[model samples]
Target chain A: MNWFLKGTLTATLLTMGGVGAMAAPGVTEDKIVLGAVDPLTGPPSLLGKAHSLALKVWQEDVNARGGINGRKVEIVFEDDGYVPARSLQSLKKMVEVDDIFALIGTSGSSQLAAMMPLIDELGIPALNNMAVNSHHFNPPLETLFVVGPTYCQELAAGMTYLVEELGLKDEKYAIAFQDDEFGDDVRCGYLAGVEKYGLDNVLELEFKRGQKDFSAEMLKARAAGVTVLVSGGVVAEHSTLLKEAAKNRMDITFLGAHSAHLTPVQALAGSAGDGYYAADYVPALTSLQVPGVARFMDLANKYLSESEMDSLNRYALSGYAGAMIFEHVMTECGEDLTRACVIEKMEGLDGFETDGLLGPVTYGEGVRHAPTGIMVLQSNAEDKTFSIVSERMEVE
Target chain B: MDYFILLTVSGIAIGVIYGLIGMGYALIFKATSVVNFAHGEIMMLISYMAFSIASSWTLPFWGLLLVCVFISAIVGLVIERVFIRPMLGQDVFSTVMVTIGLAVMIRAVVVLIWGADPLLLPTDIGDSGVEFGMVFLYTSQLYAIGLLAFCVLGMWVFLRFSRMGVAMRATAARETTALLMGINVTHVYAIAWAIAAVIAGISGVLLGTIYGLGPDLWTQGLRAFPAVILGGLDSVFGAAISGILIGVLENLSEGYIGQGLKEISGFLVILVVLMIRPYGLFGTPEIERV
Candidate 1:
């Protein structure tokens, strides 16, 4: 018994020694390589360029600080043009050919859906660039990491604010959503909100992707006496609908998902978008205290063109947050980091705060989703700026 | 009562613009058995051109509108000379397929140059709400509807009496026979495209006033397709009338249904009409030789 106990102790020490042994270059010894794919020249290219810029800013800042514990971090990006097939091809090349340590940011829900299986099979950690579907955080896989608020949560928050906070409970509400899974997720949340409030006042409408004319949809809303409009669509459709509605003089209140409240929509809608309300996950750029934003403003002024400086959209913040998390995880992993160690360290993170742009980021055994919820913004049409209507709320 | 009138009048106004644009489709199809899928893009481009000429050159609306129409006609001639001209002797199916490709290319070029952001065309015609007793009308709506009527009448006169228009009709009826009779069939083809482009330019200016100018405006071409198809692919007058009909029907359906059937009601109408008429309301009856 004494001999066996001695032998067991000796074996344990050898195993520990083996793990500590550094024969080859450690992951954080000289450089850490990461890959990202974005749509640089597609319909969503505006969002893509913003995300890539955010990634660059984060990487530059990290390198300036001596990078993840005295090592440089390198980011390689490929333009996917928002095509799912191309996104999958680029992701495969990033993993198999380039052999990136991990994928930091990817764009689009459909593009992510196409690459999800391969992402799981490769066991590579991916911080989603734009996939905000709730299922991304649910049944959390070891290889997947989501950094944004889910559409379900965002929509629910919008609904709650309209019903509980704004006293729009008795108002006749109508929903116009894109006819797809992303749209379905929003409709599900909307319906769930109506049931929870028991308002007995709801209208639902769906438009196919790329549909322009919404006269029929607007007419139906007018007929139903819909006073509150909830839209889950992109900018082009949103702007078109708003203009059409104004032409008919509906005078309805609008509540839009994040995708609908872009700069293009704001510009097109102009004065008609005065009272428009939208829920966002990231803090506004106009806020004073966000740590990195001020720095970003300085860098943007110094580096980015004047035209690009003012046009920065939501993707810019999300992209920067993604890079911030990547830096945090890599730094925490230390010099002798492996894929497993990186995952372990990232999973253990709690109260992960950024320059106050995002709420506290938390990921662990039971909790995988990180976002705190909606930051309600109302358009000040006269000023052409969004004003914070409600403090950031954690709806979920 | 207020909402109903508002919805009805606005619907009719938009439908008028659609009808005017739909007339281009009918005109091109009437002259050549080809459906111009790029019609909306052409209209969108002309509107952009008009905006550029007016804003950049500081020309008045009347001058800009006339120049825009002339430039659109030239563009139509060039498109015929380059893309459609080469496919004259090819199968009609292949020729029709080229327009689809042309539509995509136009949209890409537009986005590349202007980006995907929407641009509003500022028109001072009707800036305020004009109350007509109990109903209210925007000056812009009045302009759109009035312009639509004028374009419709112009198309009627051109097709009904002009010598060149008569030659176009002869070529449309029988390209082979017209060619044999030394009717300058090529000129007729070019003329048809030019006329179609003018209609598209007028519609574009009208629509830009109502919906703003954007790259995605090509979808309007698809939306207006059902109107032309239902009206009669070969009848210019029918296409114009059906455009207004479809627009009004869509709004009325939405106002009454409250479930969003207005969006697809035009397509539904096309489906039902196709099943019943097969050749459309004014389309030439197919005489199949078994």
Candidate 2:
């Protein structure tokens, strides 16, 4: 027999033998360690750093509250640098070396996708709050639970709001998106909305990722007389699109994915930044209206420095909310806190609350993607804030 | 037709910025025969510097530009002295590799200071634009075009007329012969780096105003490469004009052809140009007698 086959059989035997005798890998009598992988260094660190900080805030807050079921909570964070291969490596290291009980911060969609196989093989109960796609939940992994809606869901809901609430069903609706998976998701939502509303879809344009110039796209949109635009840009692209629209003096209503609900986008767009809508699953950091957010802000102020406070955003809120759900599930799993028990509990979650930080998280039989409320927020450039303009625009 | 005009005008406006950056690459390669892989990162660093300067001092546009020019000159001199000078006698590929290393270090340092978030350069210059009939150009965009013209004219006069510029051209033509002819070869290389850095610095601030400064801004350095190769790897004049050409081609392709074509249009032109004239349009061909 080959050495590989021999090692595989031995490893299988060792795993089967250990599974019956050992408690969950990361659980101890005094502490429960969770693992996270995020882009802590590169350009995507804008999202990753803020996100990890939010998770830090949750760690502090939870530990201060005596942790989950009298055991202190410890989180092990690994920097993936936003690379998919690095993400897989980080997850493996966390599972093997760190011996983490669960993963709470699964980074970007593609990065998470890269790490999904190891997660499945190891049966790691991962709570993903960062990036959600239909692929993450459909034929859902038994142990992976996702909070918040996909970009498609959020965009579709935004379309519903624009069509049903604002009565813009007659306007020339269009989507200018990056030519990638994320952009494809946004287009899916836009097309879904177009089909649902029976609206005139005048244009659907795709531009390359990292594309700064939108003059051509805007000209095309303008020539087509597009009035309503669904922007699939993340940050700078959104601002550039708005600026281009403003430069042409085109009175187009702009809607974007949650990535647009950022101060930089507005700041970059300058005077042209105002009056765009972003569909988000979580409240903005500036949103004090939500009870959970107000409390999180209070904790953030107490725990984080002013510079750290600057990193607070919807990404942070979602991260904190995901931590809250994880805490709830683990606490309910009792003192033993086995991986199976935690997975079972997560699968049975119903109406788990994070104090309006999210709509409500509920996972069911053969369904791991939780239903959450979506909000359409309008950007007020002067204030660098988003005001919620809709109610329960949740797409289950 | 209006759409075509709009795309073309915007294309030229953006093309000038690309040319400005491409000039930095061509200038370095022209003097040293070493391609600066770090050109983009250097632009990003200078842009962040401009952002910091504009934020703290509240300098007017021209005031900020002047400060950037000074800082970039110093930065270029420092980089050339510290990094490039040591590898002077080494293989050109080694020097290029050092630049790639410098690029990585500069990128890391920028992230360390700026913390990875996209920052808008704190200036009111980006606030407005001027429109003539069917097309509009941001004030910064206009500055970019004017600056490129100034650079082209200045480079033309300097290389043709000025003693220092003539020395640089001589050094570029034949380093050993220029050294034999009593040219300060090291000084020429240093001057080239400083001049290129100043160009990059100005381009950064202009682009920062146009697109906002981000970690990803270094990408403009790479995006401008097609302009450089299409112009000629070693031709500053070619780099400038091809930048305009490539920018128009990309815009027109996207405006007329489709979405994905714009991204590839410059590369397509470069492939064709390289196939036909490897030295590029208006690039002086180099021949070696075996």
Candidate 3:
């Protein structure tokens, strides 16, 4: 070979080796920095604040334990204010400026949908426990790991329990849902249950997203002789639906998704809020009997203020669980942490337990969605709390 | 048949609340020639004020309603003096923009104070309400309908006979002429704002009781806008009747169609009405819209 050709080969090999050995961004020998995008301001801050607080508790606890595998975990949060456009902006800032190794919180459903393209392009490991949509993992991004069941899966499991276990197989069912993507996911589950059990579905009602009144919807439900109702409402809609049904003096069994598992639902529905069901993957905050919940409560009490403790909800439990999963993957990666290593460890999560805080997380090979099993919870209006009413149920 | 009766009654109940909000909008426009874009936020602020009052001190519904009237009156007067009063001689468009800015501020302040969680107004009436045959209405809802009637009658009587009412009508007609005729045009504007604030307070407290109070409760103001435009923006009585008409139409459409049509049903009717009348159902071409 010519002298110039030999030197060119040596230089090219050195450049390839240097590119291969470069350390991951947002990671140092003594620290691992992650990013969180949430609706930290505005009205939806209720969810974001609680999630951020729980993650704070996790961070303090991890560092107090001499750090996870000898690297202190640091998280930088950007408020998306529950807007889709703001979510993409927040994610971009976190990637370019914060240089985050992973994302721990992905705002609301539609908000996260806005950030997916960038998430894929950046190949950043994202642990999503706040909002789980089917589209989030159907095509499957390489580094995004979802830690909970989609609204479809939760509602379907809830319907199954209502039909098979609750002995309402012959009862007529109906659904009052919104007219958007989350609502469509809910309808998918309700229809799935109808098709699987051959149950009679009398009416399928759709309403606007922020609609408050349901008098007409309830009257139509009454006209259809609906005995079982599935609600696809987000927050106040569930309470308002219950209130409207009570006003119409309808004897109906209502079931909803995880969003219904909130104290304000009972508070707004007054006495009419009693005895409704919510399907969720995480145990309720009031479920102190669970070992994981007990541990989380202890840490939260030890770390959070009185008002912050009061703000703890199902979202907090899920956030802590996400932190646990992230810590597990990070530890498994040992001192040689990288985005690809975390992705591999997360994908191989098989029945990893959160001690009853969440259902067993089992993301089989090539699957990004770790659909932990869903459980049914019944509301008690008097106390404004929920108790587990059904065993863990899996979505098919 | 029973279902229709129930839906109609419910629609009218909700419509009465909207009419109350629309009355505020109509009252401000009749007196100031500028739409108070912050009218719904005015209701929300007062309702949250009532919530705070009730939560802090255990007061009966009547007692709470009375306190809210006083507080809302002060709020309206202050808002008129501080915000709207400054833009008095400016173009109507600038005054409307000021109201819009006031609206954004009031909404943000409400969320900041009350937080974003939905709250139930504590009440002695409870949720079962009064049931007449197949129809059921909350005590607050029944009060909502009664209050609308009382407001319309009181407004009609006051505007027809009272000296202040004559002054208000003159000011609404021509501020410069009213000023020249020693009518105290600014005082008329203040009185108009105060009365509108009282009506909004009543509606706010009642609606909060029925629907459960939240930060976005101000959106109901926008919902009542069609009532204002559909009835004649300058005609308070027309706004009330149009509110009822729109509410009933929304409920009936939702009942019959069942595909989220209720949200746009009122707007659709308003579109048809505007296309036909050009200046709303009751608005006059040159003057005397009231």
Candidate 4:
């Protein structure tokens, strides 16, 4: 085993030396491959698997319509299992082994941060995905594009509505965030929004991912008499928070991050989600009024089970929308199918709309951020469904 | 102050689950002297089975729990026969490795079957908060605590009075002497695993209700390890008590110190406990031949 490992390592190094002079290790004619490394088998696998499946569906749909202008778009997906080291390894394999046109729909900030140097060196036209970190926006790369609103924009929209529109400018609020990059971005957004609006009455608490109990955190919020609670964590943590608050009979309203808008929340939180709210970039799955979303629901029914269809989760819709964006970008590139042409067309697209999955994605000078619209969803216990209580509002 | 109580209750609820599983670990170690590293995986697998039987087949919770326990017991027997039985005379390291491998295999099989997506397992115990003076408690939390208490009493009584339990104790006391006295050590080992599996099933189901079913459930095995060690690997009651202690301690640390200290604090307590009492708080001090 030792001898074999050594020989393989030597071969890999020799191959790298030979291939390093090329544009990338694995670009080929008649096919443009992309890599998607995300957690598909670990704790956060829910998000990764959903994103992958959405990408799959989109790619199939595009292929059926003549394959990205006659050049097939294939994605060589790698499961990073939500770790930085694993993500780096997968990114290397994707760039070296199954080289493709560009990468899209990656998950997690830390995972993306690990691949930043490679992305910069390769000058790859990478999408920021649904990661929502501020680093993706700061000192922006010429080849990178953010197809969704940044965490700051999303949080600003939520807080702006609460402060200016809802007449809750002076309302007592508490922020509970995960202790990670994503959480920091959320806090930054909230802080910026509060200052911009000159709003007062806010407190902050933080929790780590995979930490189940949140009683002490909730107690501090309770002591402060917080009316609104914002959390930057996943479904499990939110559910535990809701259950604990319900136990304490606290009248505080819960606000979840975009990622926590999931199917499991309803069951996990149970009655604790009676009046919970979340800020969403896309229309709620419960909204059948939108044409594109109606079509999406119909397609989901045909392809997936009702149980499998977490129609309310903005992530799934975002996943589906991401696939659509790739298709549109490929079409704009025409028959040339080169990475440069695709990037040129993508950066040139102004006010590109997606029938309400998002408002418009326009990449231009001093305007790399896209889709600043957010809607607030309130959980209704009587029907066991979340209803959009506020209309879509634009950020700035 | 109010928040502290809330955190303590929530922590205790989760601690009860750890205590129950830790009890299973301690019980198995006492009788067979083999650490069942796969206990959490077994529990998760049995919970999935219960979901299939209860929700899919429409069995009631009570009926599902009973059927799940029976199936888990059989699975425990099969594991011992196939894995542990082969390493009867082997060193302790070999047995431990086999169980670790078995843990990996169980998690892999589960992922393959379940497709690595988180599954929702809604408990039928009514989702209303019970008011207790100033504090509120989820029905599931109360249900979990009640179940833990029942299991602790049941285990205590069984070990004190039951013939099979007494035989298991005898085997643990002196394997060669018990064999010479006509006690079937093999049966004792199988029973130990069986009992452990039942307790694990309860923990799995409760945890599923609290936190949805996912492939990451195996991490609980690692988290439960500290509790088992702290309570003494061979002391069943000690394991249960320490599980709660660790759980409460973790929450308190996170609550007071802040900055995501629950995970670190739990391990810190384990380290401190080990340094002070090498054999664990309640672990039987072994008298080595050397």
Write down the TM-score of every candidate: 0.90, 0.97, 0.95, 0.88
Considering lDDT, which of the candidate structures 1 and 4 is the better prediction for this target? 1
RMSD of each: 6.2, 2.3, 4.5, 4.6
> Worst ten-residue run, lDDT, model 2 chain B?
B122-131
Per-prediction DockQ comes to: 0.32, 0.77, 0.71, 0.44
lDDT tens string, model 1, A1-70?
A: 2355346545654765764563221244588888888887746777887888778777877787788878
What are the per-residue Cα lDDT tens digits for candidate 3 across A229-322? 9999988999999998888889999999998998888999988999999999998988999999999999999999998897888899999999
**Chain A TM-score relative to the true structure, per candidate:** 0.89, 0.95, 0.94, 0.87
lDDT of 4 at B238: 88
Indicate the residue-level lDDT of B30 in model 1: 85
iRMS per model in Å: 3.0, 1.0, 1.1, 2.7
Single out the weakest 10-residue window by summed lDDT for candidate 3 chain A. A1-10
Candidate 2 chain A least-lDDT 10 residues: A1-10
Taking the tens digit of each residue's C-alpha lDDT, what string does model 4 give over A1-396?
235534764576577675444333234445667777767876677778777766666666666667765767788789998898888788777765676568885667778878777776666767765676657656666666776666667777777767776677777877888877777777876887778877664578777766666776776667778877777776677777787677666887677767656766766677776878777787767778877677677676666656566522566677777667767886786655656766777778787777788777777764445654787777765566667777878766
Residue B34 miss distance in model 2 (angstroms): 1.6
**Candidate achieving higher TM-score, 1 or 2:** 2
Fnat for model 4? 0.57
Candidate 3 residue spans exceeding 4 A from truth: A1-21, B287-290
Model 4: how far is A298 from its true place, Å?
4.2
Q: For each candidate, how many residue pairs have backbone atoms clashing (under 3 Å)? A: 1, 0, 0, 3
lDDT of 2 by residue, B100-150 (tens): 999999999999998888889987676677879878888989989999999
lDDT of 3: 0.89
